[model samples]
Target: MKHLSLSAQRFPRRATSAVAAAAVAFAFAGCANYSGISSDKQIAAPDKFEATQSVPGQGGQWPSLDWAKQFGDPQLPQLIDEALADNPSIAQAQARIAKASSYIDTSRSALYPKVNGSYSWTRELYSANALFPPPYGGTWYSENNALVSASWDLDLWGKNRARLNQAVSQEKAAEADMQQARVTLAASLARTYNQLALLYALRDVAQREIANRQDVGRITNGRVAAGLDTNVERRTAEGNVATSQTSLTELDGQIESVRYQLAALLGKGPDRGLQIAKPVIDPKVNVTLPDNIPADLISRRPDIIAARWQVEAATQNIKEAKAEFFPDINLTAAFGFDAFGWSKFLQSSSRQIQFGPAIHLPIFDAGALRAQLKGRYADFEGDVANYNQTLVSALNDVATNISAIRSLDKQMSDANRALTAATSAYQLAVIRYKAGLSPQLQVLNADDNRLANEQTVTNLRLKRTDLQIALIKSLGGGFDATSTNLAIDGSGQQQAANPTTNQTSPSQ
Candidate 1:
């Protein structure tokens, strides 16, 4: 009995000593091989844009809120509003954003633990004298086993984190792209709406021409009946009326074609309620536009920001890809109970456990790893180039639009003056003809000149409006003086993230 008591005490001490030694070993193992990521919070974006030319610009301020309200046409506002809401391209951009966000979530999943469960059952018959023969009686009994295992790749190399960062950057890029698409769509819809308005105004002019020709035809027929006009003269007047009416009919078809395009922009069928009302031409609209936009407004552009974010994502990808050259460390372990009998499975003596770390260093695989690194490096270079290009394009767009707006302003003034002169001439010819002082052909020619001049002026107005839109687009689409207050100071403001360019991320 004493021997048994002593044995029990000795066993407990031995077990305790073993446990203490194992814990120390584990602590030493865990403290090994530590590394840190560099926390340099500065993003090195490409240099900013600088225009090469000193171009002249209209000096007056352009109205903010991108005011189409100057047209005083309620229909213009309604069409723009409805198109923004129902445009399929806008919806597509939204979907891209959502899809990219989800992909980012997927990329981030690597930061967490990974667990797997597996089970198996195997049986085999062995001939006599085989290794251990058949375990029990007969050929073989059922062999059943199950394992619940888990593994986690420690991000000591920052590979997973870098990948996560890349995804985040891409996601931000996608957001910018989506916004850019929205502005582009809005700009397109506005431009088409204005085009339709021009067609309506031009149609009205054609109708006036038709009315004047009809009046001349009636006068010539009356004169012919009174023996004061030759048959050839009356026929000539009727022929002019027919020619004007034909031109009017042709223009009417062209006008409907523009309306159909507007309907499609609104995502409706040809016969849908694209009930576009005519927009009135406002003769009092101020054509003077601002030319000297501030240089620091580039960041507000969705495309520019999107390109910047693309650079960020590419930068993170290069980091992640470069990390692949280093050794990847993985940890795997399991803790469970195993026993020959089910009753003993819970016993401490029946406990089973294992743990280990694995490292994979690139030795050689026919230069595949090096090729990957090179490829990623090339990709980084490409991203840098793309960013520079985007910046340059943005700069050129603003400069060109500013120059155009100024030139159009001058031309529009000249056109209006010409139109006024033509109107005076047309009125004078009408007075002389009524007093029997001028031939009908002279009156007809003067009125034709006036009508043509008016059409030219109306076209110039529409052209100016279009130029306004272009200037607005060049100014980064609705971004204005207020954006100067929200300066991007290059302090990793957006580039430091792991983003997914799912904002349709320049999807190349």
Candidate 2:
């Protein structure tokens, strides 16, 4: 082998040593010391709900996905689909999700190097008295240059990673919020639609009552003409007719009001809502509960899921804040051509390369960094509290709906029995009056009782339907929290974690 001179090898060795020393210095100076916090920290959670008996599902089973179908209304599903597609609230939620997803991209960009390219052309005049002292006394020059530059921030303490984690969590939270909006819109539409249906039924009832009263008024008028009844009875029958007409009028106003509301929910004009036909709901439809309703299903509630993500995002924010207390290491490099003249700039000899590491130490901030960390900690604590509160509220909502449904069921049964007895009594009284065995007043009283009982049954049925809708909403409208993958770690990396199970601490 040919031996190289020591002089030649010495320069290369010295250059290599210089680069190694610079790297060591940069690493030491830019070292960050941070104790990352994990989102796995435990908070208070209930193992069982207070009103467990109200749940009808079997253990480990959740509510059916097609819960709205239980109403037996064919138009309901179509209405819900339209609302989901057109409702302003749902659209807003979806926009937020898109915004959050963009944020995730922004945060992730920080983890990698950024490369930029530029080209410039300039004409300049130099003063003879200036430092440049014009190349030739005072001269104008034209120059063209093209350059490429690259820079990257080294996440020595996972600061960028933490930011990315926060972004991911926020995106997941937004998704949950969107789901929540869908569930809420569906529930509201269903409730309003049910109300409209009930109103229509009530209006029919009023019409029937008006007809009955009118018949009574005619009979009383005939009796008075025949000297069989007094003027007082005729006036009483007319008063009853007036009352029924008033009820019918009021119901008409209510129906229109509800129609307007439903139209708004459908993202349409009031006139468009009036075009919707009267909803057909089976009054006897029963929502079957699973044999065992596990309390854990509350976690599947979209609100609860969103709350949990907020908490995790807050935890990641704390990590990011803590990381800021340490030094930041950014590496920048540029390579391109530069020269006083366009011809020279294009020459290979004009090519230049420059590279170095920039370090930023948190030397003097007047406790600003500490204050930020404190605020982040406070925010995380607040989020945790919110999560707990939301969970509890969700459980309470389910329990309340269950209790209401059970009570309504009993009331419906009793109302049915009363309606049956009143109807029978009214039929008997009418027969007796026709045969001249009972007074006209007795028949009027029986008819009033029957109408009242009928109204009770109708109102109770509406209440039952409302309760079922409430129960579905409380149960998250069949949202499955487990379908989402949200992972919050100090490193800002998403790892699949089961929301139903306690999350393990993420590796730094």
Candidate 3:
């Protein structure tokens, strides 16, 4: 083995001292003065929700993470858990978090010295006439070298610190993105499950209507044979039966289509959806809305939080770009041993060391650095704008869903009353027709009205379920950034119910 010697010299002692003093002074002068923009002032949110205030017993409480469980469906949480484990979007978001975390490591590397070690061996033969005239020049020699080197870029202008900050912010954003994906997937599954239940309910209605229409057709046929009714009445009755059958067929198709959609969401094939049992949902289940929801809590929404993180990352980027306009100071050191023969490699006389400071002053580059700084600032402004838009859109979604849920409550009540009255009217018409006090047309008309009202009532009930799901989603679907890990463990085991906690708001 042989060792390699290292040597470095740039400035004399006095000159080096002066340069160090000057660098210190420049570093103090170049301290970052620009503070980032605040999303709080840029975006406006209402202090309290207006639509939810009218709901009794709401008490302005934040929604629970087990909001879906309020429907008393044992299968919903299981389905959501399966989707979270299997959904490709959720996996992708998790991958992004991993990538961003790696980036944080990359950025943090700039704050510490980089050290490397190496070992090498070389064998060479020299020509007789190159350096010496005789056998000395013709001799073959082997050399071995071992070396270790280190370098560090001093973060005098906070450039490296800014980069690290940017990476950390991006990592946080990625985490929020993961949480957002989970929230979205859970909500989608809940909606799809509810839709499936609605379809089943509608299918029952269609079957009943078909049977009623067929009965009307049979009665009309009997009256026609006795010359009490014309062929026109029989044909009309037959037409109603066909219409009801057609409606049944359409509902079946819709049911299958929704099943396939749900299967895809569960990360399974369409055939798997057919194996799912019909959902048993109570139409009377009413979801309560929170009264006086605080505007600040909107910031807890994952999408909003993700957008805020982006703004923070952009601010750090601007600071990094600004730091590039100042001078850079770097230090390097190397230690090695050089020897011609393997036996002498570890000798003290062969040992060597080298150390120096390098300074980089950007004297000229046209306007590239300034332009870069301007671009960074522009990006920061754009991020701020995006953040504001996201905030407004989030608030709008909450408000709109709240209003819809309230409206549905009233519509559902009206529909229930109308259905009951129609049912009574239908029974009266049937009794009158059997007694020969009313024409068959009157009974058929009443039957059609009852069927129509029944369908309306079912539709209203489904619509209310959909609206409640939407409202829950708008309220962040009970997703809490602090409880993300507990809510989604990715294992088949049941996740812990998300508990309420005070979450740190993003810096404005």
How do the residues 1-508 of candidate 1 rate in per-residue lDDT, one tens digit apiece? 0000001112355674565455445433432221222222232332333343533345755445445566676676676677778888888888887888887888788877788776555664555575665454346544444567777777666788878877877777777887677677667877887787777778788888888777777767766777666798788877888887887888878878888888887788866534776766463555444554334444657787777677677767756755665555566676666555356656777666665554555544565655665566566666756766776777677677767767877888888898899889978876775555677788778877888888998888787777766656665666432343322334334443322221112111
Candidate that would win on lDDT: 2
lDDT of 1 at 145: 47
- Write down the TM-score for model 2: 0.86
Number of the candidate with higher lDDT, 1 or 3: 3
Backbone clashes counted, model 1: 15
TM-score of each model, paired residue for residue? 0.79, 0.86, 0.84
CA displacement after TM-score superposition, residue 276 of candidate 3 (Å): 1.7
lDDT (0-100) at residue 294 of candidate 2?
A: 40
Better of 1 and 2 by lDDT: 2
Question: lDDT of all the models against the reference?
Answer: 0.64, 0.75, 0.72
**lDDT tens per residue, model 2, 1-508:** 1111111112365674576466556544543333443334344446634545555554334555577787789898888888888888988998999999999999999999999999888898877787676464489887778889898898877788888978988999998899888888899999999999999999999999998888777878877888888999888989999989999999999999999999999988889787888899876765555443444554568887788788778767776776775556677778888888766887889887766656566645666766776677667767777877887787778778878888888888898999999999988987776666788889888998999999999999987888878877887788876555642343322221211122222223
Give one digit per residue, the lDDT tens place, for model 3 in 71-190.
Answer: 778878787888888888988998999999899999999999999999999987878889765665888887889999999998777888878978887888888888888888888988
Q: Decide which is better by lDDT, 2 or 3.
A: 2
